[model samples]
Target: MRWFIFIAIYILVDIYAFQAIRTLTKNPWIYSIYVFLSLAVLAALIYQVSTLGAGKVLDIKSMYVFGIFLTVFVPKLLIVVFMFGEDIARFFVGIFMKVAGSDEAQFMASRRKFVSTIALGIAAIPFASLLYGMIQGKYNYKVLKYSLEFDDLPEEFDGFTLTQLSDVHSGSFDNREKVEYAVNLINEQQSDVILFTGDLVNNLAEEMDDWKQLFSSLKAPNGVFSILGNHDYGDYVKWDSAAAQAENLRKLKNIQNEMGWNLLLNENRFIEKNGQKIAVVGVENWGLNGFKQAGDINKACEGISNSDFKILLSHDPSHWQAQVKDSPRNFQLTLSGHTHGMQFGIEIPGIIKWSPIKYRYKNWAGIYEEFGRYINVNRGFGFLGYPGRIGIWPEITVIKLKRKKPQT
Candidate 1:
């Protein structure tokens, strides 16, 4: 909806600017008139945006949804495939006429219809997928079973289970009812600890209230912990004042608190159970730049012993580059959720296929072990711009650490 409004505004501005420039070559009055008209349109758009929001104008957000779908979606394909599905049937009709005989000329006459129908159907799949994604688009939740093993064992911490879920961008969730279902799904895991890797919301920090009720229902046997994701800082949206943005962050943090989560910002906490000790470290939204950089491993790991079984929660899988591999730290496991697989792709039997998001991210999902360090990226519990999960589902990571035999 916002995209449509933005496009409409851009079209208006383009018209006015083009007319204004053309008129400048003739007379001052003509140029002034066009310029004034452009400003008037912009003013009107601003006023309307203030009153009803972009959502008011989008009665049927499907037709011109290309502006929102193009990033990872294609709609023209939908129109040709679904709308003009007759061609597909006629193509088969011609094939039957040519092969089985009877009415070759008649078949030829209607073959294009079949072809058109098929093309439209083929196109309709992704578009409908996008449309359905807009409507019933949901988060994929999978319990990625992996372990980080070290030579030493924390006596009481062995066999501890941590339920990990990440990238629950509440802002992109348009279905309030579905979100409640998701909450129920997460609660069903019932792990000893719940850790959220990041990306709690898509754009605005104020979106916290939207899912407050749903989040309030989440409870674990031990406790819930969270770290800031890139989106949590509210960088994508424009605010009238920086203070407003700051206050928004504060509100987001408060929401986390209300949800019974401990926001571990570049800090560590000890989990002592059965006389065994383990450290849980959390960092801010730090990544490889052009993203957030609030994660401070140094601060998070400060005063930690070398041998502690440290579980670090960093939003980005890229953060493993900075803290896990070569850093002089003992972070046994790091949890991240910057990538939700863009809610596309496949996870089939022996054939993990689909989606181009893999081209951008090496360890986008599942457990990735590099240089003896480990990181797990969650598929996420919410949708983004296109708003659907075709195959690469959202996840609920059930991580159970294990012991590894020493290399003799």
Candidate 2:
């Protein structure tokens, strides 16, 4: 039924957009080519989606197939919108002319070539943008830096810095060179410690087999700490036995250990400097939207005190809003990455920052602060459903902890 609706919508949009093409060009060859290509794209999309297994990971080939569909469909959808608007106006004009006793021929006007031309011209923008995004925008990595000042921050860790990475859907990655470049970029920050709020694989442990060595090279003096995201449990995959699913998760945990990452599972570790210490608490995946709730904040905090400057690593930002914000235990800062900024949006720094995902998640991207506590939702280190990123590029976040001095 869902597939039926999808095909119906695409065909309807394509037919409407074709009206504009016909108005602009009477050439039979152009019409034949356009219809042929549109049908071919539709067929490919259906085949690609059908082949996707229970895991629904969208590997490299699937990614490109979906990418092609978007490149063609988006522009045509826009053209349909414009053409539909013109039809509505024409309908009203015809009704007015008939009421005024005008001739039938004069009552209804021909479809305007100018309107079709304008619609086609405007539609080209998204067509070209989607193509560019698939080609170059996916690997466009950006380093986001933040210096957060906390009155209770330990003085010994005043300039302490940590880099946070999250949502590495390794199975979706196709370019190893690009992955290597991003790995090197993370190390270049040279943070005191590297914190990974996870989604290490799409649905399998072996997804990371090819890229393990590259990621293992990531170095920080204080060490690299990580926690699981919802995807780590192999929840989306079908297994022959329950044990098989559990073993997949076990392998992922072991892989992280092999790469020298401290896989914190509902536990806390202290980063001591001189005599002062701060807590790094990690929990399993916890989300509000029926997602995995394996995370236990209270258990993770364990013997840590409220006075300790604490950094919490949880995968979904929704966790912060739901539990962390009002908790009696003070989590000074929280880091997460699951939204991926919807992998598409219009962001112009101070001017504008918006994505469709924002309607679902208030703190979808960048940093959010409330009641003197901060959470930076990393835009993600990889892509998922959408093969390419439009505006929200992959992120590597560097956060510097500073102690606020008391005013005299």
The global C-alpha lDDT for each of the candidates, from Candidate 1 onward, is 0.69, 0.91
Listed in order, each prediction's TM-score against the native is 0.73, 0.95
Off by more than 4 A, model 1: 1-118, 139-150, 405-408
Question: Listing every candidate in turn, what is its Cα RMSD in Å to the true structure after a full C-alpha superposition?
Answer: 11.3, 1.9
The deviation in Å at residue 54 for candidate 1 is: 13
lDDT per residue for candidate 2 within 172-224, as digits (tens), equals: 89888999999999999999999999999988999999989989998999999
Across 262-377, the per-residue lDDT of candidate 1 in tens digits comes to 98988988888767778889999888747878877888888798788888898888778765766667677888888777677767846665567777777787787766777788
Write down the RMSD of candidate 1 (Cα, Å). 11.3
The Cα error of candidate 2 at residue 283, in Å, is 0.4
Worst 10 residues of 1 by lDDT: 55-64
Tell how far residue 225 is off in model 1, in angstroms. Answer: 0.9
* lDDT, candidate 1, at 373: 70
TM-score, prediction 2: 0.95
